[model samples]
Target: MAAADVIFLVISIIAVGAAALAVTRKNPIYSALFMMVTLLVVAAVFQMLSSPFLAVMQVLLYAGAIMVLFTFVIMLLSLRPEEMGETAPLPQRIFAAVVALGVFALLAFPAIEPGVPAAAASLAPPAAEAVRFPPAAGTGDGATVEFGATAYFGHTIFGRFVLPFELVSILVLAAVVAVMVLAKRDLSKRDVADDGSDRDPPPLSVSAAHAGSIASLATSTQPTSHGPGA
Candidate 1:
């Protein structure tokens, strides 16, 4: 294998290990740190594939933006110290492990037998045909990579994929609205209820019951003034 391939493999392994550590670490902070490590390693791997754009995107989008968001959320949540019950039940954990293992096995079966490159090549043409759309017209830069060019300059944005993009935008807007609603406290009702002046007047019967006695007490309590000459 080429040096680049070996380096990529090493990076991939480190990324996988870091991801596993992130999942298994008991401390939330450590988990987040490990996740950052994994993202950095994955970004390095992307660079090895001659896609500097994707590498930068991986670091900027995932490592910088998403991880920052994740860590900020974790900090905000202020997760309590790990308790015994924090992890999944043993049986469920084991079941999840088995399912993941099975999926890994199924995926690796063909990969190890013939290798990933062959499998990818085999899958590409038919899948491409299935997702076929007209070639996007672009500035005559023949150097444009397939996905980047297609996604950025595609006619489908206004044509076939319009609804999907619109749906995604609506979904994002809804999420923003939900976040605002959650973060803001509605005090109008509470404020109105709490205003002492807005309280119902004392019961008429109760006021009447004490009115005479209070009036008499006030009258009796009034200080008398005698003429100075007298």
Candidate 2:
């Protein structure tokens, strides 16, 4: 096998291991970290797939930016042990495992099934027979660029999908703002609890309040105003 195939296999193994750790980790931060590793390895796989632009985006957009955002949100939430909740019930765990296995089988079957072409032409035709991309411009000049080349992807995205793209940016911005708000609210609550711990006395019980009222009534019998001055 070629060196490229060996590298690809190594990357794929790392990606799978990291992904499994990401899924099974009890700590969300660890899970997120493992997920970041998986994303980075996936980016390397994308590079091996001859998709340099996708590789760069997978690194920048997912492994870098999105992971940072997720980390911030997770830290801000500060989930407690109780909030993490008890382990899943046996039935739920079993169900989840079954579903995961089903999905794995579905994805694996197409590649491993006997008689399927190495390129999986049964599922998708050879690249040569694939539908052609709409050329960057009319056919006046015989110019061609690979789809998702840096220049081509940028032009296609900004030209055709600009509005949806902008909307997604807005959504990400809104999520960041929301996370900040939630973090501020959480911090403020913590501050109040810490600061007020001594300042706010425990509430009076009913019996204590009644006893205090009776004491006040007893002490009121002095009646200074109705004494000798009257």
Q: Could you tell me the lDDT of residue 179 within candidate 1?
A: 50
For each candidate in turn, give its C-alpha RMSD to the true structure in angstroms. Answer: 22.8, 20.8
- TM-score of structure candidate 2: 0.58
Each prediction's number of clashing residue pairs:
0, 0
lDDT for 118 in candidate 1 is: 88
Clashes of 1: 0
lDDT of each: 0.59, 0.64
- TM-scores, one per candidate: 0.57, 0.58
- Deviation in Å, model 1, residue 67 alpha carbon: 1.0
- Give per-residue CA lDDT, model 1, range 1-230, as digits (tens): 99888887888899999989977765555566788999999889766756566778889877896666555545544433332123456898799899999999988787678676786777543434324554435764344434434343344455657899999878766665655454336734543355585564432332233334433322222122211221
* Candidate 1 similarity to native, TM-score: 0.57
Q: After superposition, how far is residue 6 of candidate 1 from its true place, in Å?
A: 1.6
